[model samples]
Target chain A: MKAIGSFKGEPITDSDSLVDVEVPTPDLAEHDVLVEVKAVSVNPVDTKLRAGAPSQKEPLILGFDAVGIVVKTGSNTTKFSKGDRVWYSGTTKRPGSNEAYQAVDERLVAKAPRSLTDEAAAAMPLTSITAYELLFEKMGANFGQLANPGKTLLIVNGAGGVGSVLSQLAKWAGFTVIATASPANFDWLRANGVDQPIDYHDDLETQVQGLGHHFVDAAVILYDVPSYYDAVTKLVAPGGHIGAIVGTQAKLNMEQLKSKSLSLDWEYMFAKGDFDFRMETQGEALRQIAQLVDNNFVHTTLSRTIDSGLNAKNLREAHQVVEEGHVVGKVVVSGPFNGQVNE
Target chain B: MKAIGSFKGEPITDSDSLVDVEVPTPDLAEHDVLVEVKAVSVNPVDTKLRAGAPSQKEPLILGFDAVGIVVKTGSNTTKFSKGDRVWYSGTTKRPGSNEAYQAVDERLVAKAPRSLTDEAAAAMPLTSITAYELLFEKMGANFGQLANPGKTLLIVNGAGGVGSVLSQLAKWAGFTVIATASPANFDWLRANGVDQPIDYHDDLETQVQGLGHHFVDAAVILYDVPSYYDAVTKLVAPGGHIGAIVGTQAKLNMEQLKSKSLSLDWEYMFAKGDFDFRMETQGEALRQIAQLVDNNFVHTTLSRTIDSGLNAKNLREAHQVVEEGHVVGKVVVSGPFNGQVNE
Candidate 1:
């Protein structure tokens, strides 16, 4: 099987940063489903892993989001069968979805949205799962339930991949969505379901307050938590929740939340897969997200797609575009494997 | 009205630390219930407030937990009448319950347990509400539901005020309760529904693992967070919750919880009163707790009662006992107001 991988933690500018390699096909575990990956998306996790991950003896495949067709299944697999089209953000502890053929836990795999293409489907799993979990699990929003009609959500970096989907999900869950994005992406943010799009460069507290909202019922930060910590703390209403995906370099002053009875939660989408805790919920979430996407409640956040096909060269280019940090939404490498085959 | 209060932050040993004074009777708000306090409990909050609260022109009355008879009611009050027996952990924002009379919001007060004395019922509201919210609201435990039979909880300082009630609440909610305290308090902990009581001075991880649990579903720290953080993090199961009442002075290394996707929540019982967010829920929780107490599912954590009554000297002595920090459970002041009446 041919895969795009990196052996050393190096900048994307280095030719060896991500290169094509032939590796043996992965063996299936009892709950595994072998997927012939058709498309994969590049995320901040890929760039971060490529730049700072310890050098491994074997090259580390670094894509978490993929859309694929099931090629084989383990003897004990129950949810999926061969020939099924699936989408998932696979585990971080195992080899990722950047390879031609990868074995993923059946519990994390879900049928892709029938209304979307493989590239569009691939763009969603990671960010959609992240957004779903961030809203429902971490922040205590009811799953697909409109129980909180007047509630408000403040999404930081609302034009990004996770935020684009998150804005839609928040709106679906009955939150009046307020988001922060660059002026260039304001229209896109509004189109994605944000009721108000404030420029991230402006004073966030002032901007949020200007909308006649004293504080938001919940706040989700998709980017640097430390830089947005004070703003989030100030913007979150009493008994509100603040969730983040990224880890902070410095220690957080947790006492700031004590007075407001605010809750601070970290939503790492890979935690379930990494710890083997409630992995089935990931599949359930993806299934629900696919339904929403098919129903047109959520649109694909695939802003850029490399239609030339999946190869080390194209994946590297996708990684470069993601590394630049100005991409509006997701960047995916689509179509069948074009690299040299090993088996 | 006669009240025991402090004009300056001073040691309990100081003569004027908590002195008897005459203050004007409180004017009731539309939703206020004026209670003739019969008994009040001294918690760590009282001692802390006495030691460092800023001096006020009028002395600050610092008791939060109280059981009293409603003497008067405001026009808009619906929950209580003029002759009802009520118990509440009143707000910190107003003059607390350490006086002859207190005007508290009707929404924050609930009927006292029918089976217990005023002193016994008084010992519960603060700790009970704290425990209830920490378990249910902050840590995601289902309120009044036995939804988690196999789940386990680790209660740090199980013999303390909040911990004593929390252990029972966790047990009632179907969690297998594990707690840490001195060996002397182990029997008390067991009586309070702790399934396994480990010595706090010994190795906590080793003690917990010896009980055949590698991790707990949840952990609550009634004392210092930073001191128990590492142990709590290691002992918490994947996707578990860790809650605390006390704030840390130093910055916390929150990244330690990232791998397991654990949440760290701070439970401040006064938050509802301070921020005016969902004060009704406090009353609802108290009403539920009172029913639990009356039904014998939970018991008052009152270990000591100052029968000498509510006065400056007895309150100061109670404050001294709390400041010493070795008491097994709550210390409370019972009986009539002995100071000179203002009216």
Candidate 2:
């Protein structure tokens, strides 16, 4: 199998930062399905992992989101069959989707939406799963129903990958969506179902208050939580929730949330896969997300595509774009493998 | 009206720490219910507030738990009538419960259980409400049902006021309760429905794992959060919840909970009243708690009583006991008001 990997922590501009390599095809365990990778998306995690991860005996493959086809299944697998199309965000502890073939747990894989192309389907899984879990699981929003009608949500960095889908999901869940982004991306945010788009450069507290909401029912920070911690805390209603995907270096002032009896939740997409806790919920979430996508309730967040196909060079380019941190939605590298293979 | 209060932050042994004062009777608001105080319990919050609260033009009264008879009601009040017995944990923003007469919102008061004495009933409201909210609202357990059968809870400082009630509530909710206290309090803990009482003086993780539970579904820190954070985080099952009532002075490492998708919840009993967020729920919780107490499903945690009655001297002594921090359960001052009155 042909794959692109980073041998050591290095800047993306270095030619050897992400190099072509040959690794044996992964073996399937019980409940595993072998996936023939078709399309993959680049996220901020890829960039971070590529630049700072320790050099390993084997080069580290860095990718999480993929749309692929089931090539084979382990003896105990029941949810998927060979040739079935699927989409998922693979586990963090295992080899990722930046390869020609990968083995993923069947419980974490779901059927890809029939209404979208492989590139588009690949773009939705990671962000969709994250957004769904953040709203429903972490923040206590009801799933598959408008249970939170008239409630408000504040999404920081609303023009980014997770924010793009999260705003739509939160809106569909009957919450009034307030998102923050640059003025240049305001239209994009509004088009994606954001009820109010506040410029991130402005004073967030003042801008949110200008919209007549004294406090939001929930706040999701897609960016640095500490930088916006004070603002987010002040904007949260009593007994409300604040969720974050990005880890912070600064110590958090937990006392700020004490008076309101608020909750601080950390939503890491790989947690279930990493700890083997409720892994089937990922498949369930994806199945529902696929229905939402096919029903036109949600559209693909694929903002850019590397048409040159899945190769070391194209993936490197995608990583560089993600590292820049201002991409409107998602950047995917698609098509057949073009790197050298030893298998 | 005669009241006991502190004019300045001072040691409980100081003669002026808590003194008798005569003030005008409180005027009623639209939803106010005036109660003739009978008994009140001393909690750590009372001690902390009494010793650290700023001096005021009017002496600061510091009591939260009270059992009394309703003497009057405001125009819009409907929950209670004159002469009805009631129990409540009043709002922190109000004058509190250490007085002959108190004006509390009708929505925050509930009928006191007929099965228990005034002192016993008074010991319950604050801790019961805190325990109920921590389990059901904060940790997502179902209210009044054995919804979490076979699940486990770890309650730190299980002999304290909140812990004593929380252990019983968790048991009633069908969760296996694991509590930490000194070996001397093991009998008290077991009597309060703790299934496994580990010595807080020993290694917590080793003690918990030895009891055959690698992790708990929820962990509540009734004491210091930072001191128990590492053990609690490690002992919480994946996708579990950790709640704290006592605030931490140290900055929390929120990243430690990221890998397990754990939630850090702050449970302040006065939050709803402080922010006017769902104040009716406190009364609702108390109503259900009263039913539980009357049915003998849960019992009062009042371990000690001061026969000297509701006066400055007795309150100061109670404060001293709470400040010492080794009491088995709640310490309360009961009987009639024996102080000078303005009327």
Fraction of native Cα contacts reproduced by each candidate: 0.47, 0.69
Per-residue alpha-carbon lDDT of model 2 for A150-236, expressed as tens digits? 899999999999999999998888899999999899999988889999999999999999999989989999998889999999999
Worst 10 residues of 2 chain A by lDDT: A334-343
- Best candidate, lDDT-wise? 2
What C-alpha RMSD does candidate 1 show over the true interface residues after superposing them?
A: 1.5
Candidate 1, B1-343: lDDT as tens digits:
8888999999889989999888889999999999999999998988998899787898898899999999999989998987899999989889999999999998999999999999899889999998998888888887765667889999989999999999999889999999999999899999999999999999889999999997788898877888888988888876678888888777777677766767777788888888777899999999999999989999988889998878899998999999999998889898888856554
Best by DockQ: 2
lDDT of 1 by residue, A259-331 (tens): 7777887778888887788899999999999999999899999999998878778888999999899999899
Clash pairs, model 1 backbone: none
Q: Following a full C-alpha superposition, what root-mean-square deviation does model 2 have from the true structure?
A: 1.6
Give candidate 1 regions above 4 Å deviation: A54-57, A339-343, B339-343
Q: Chain A TM-score for each candidate, in the given order?
A: 0.97, 0.97
Docking class of 1: medium
Candidate 2 clash pair list? none
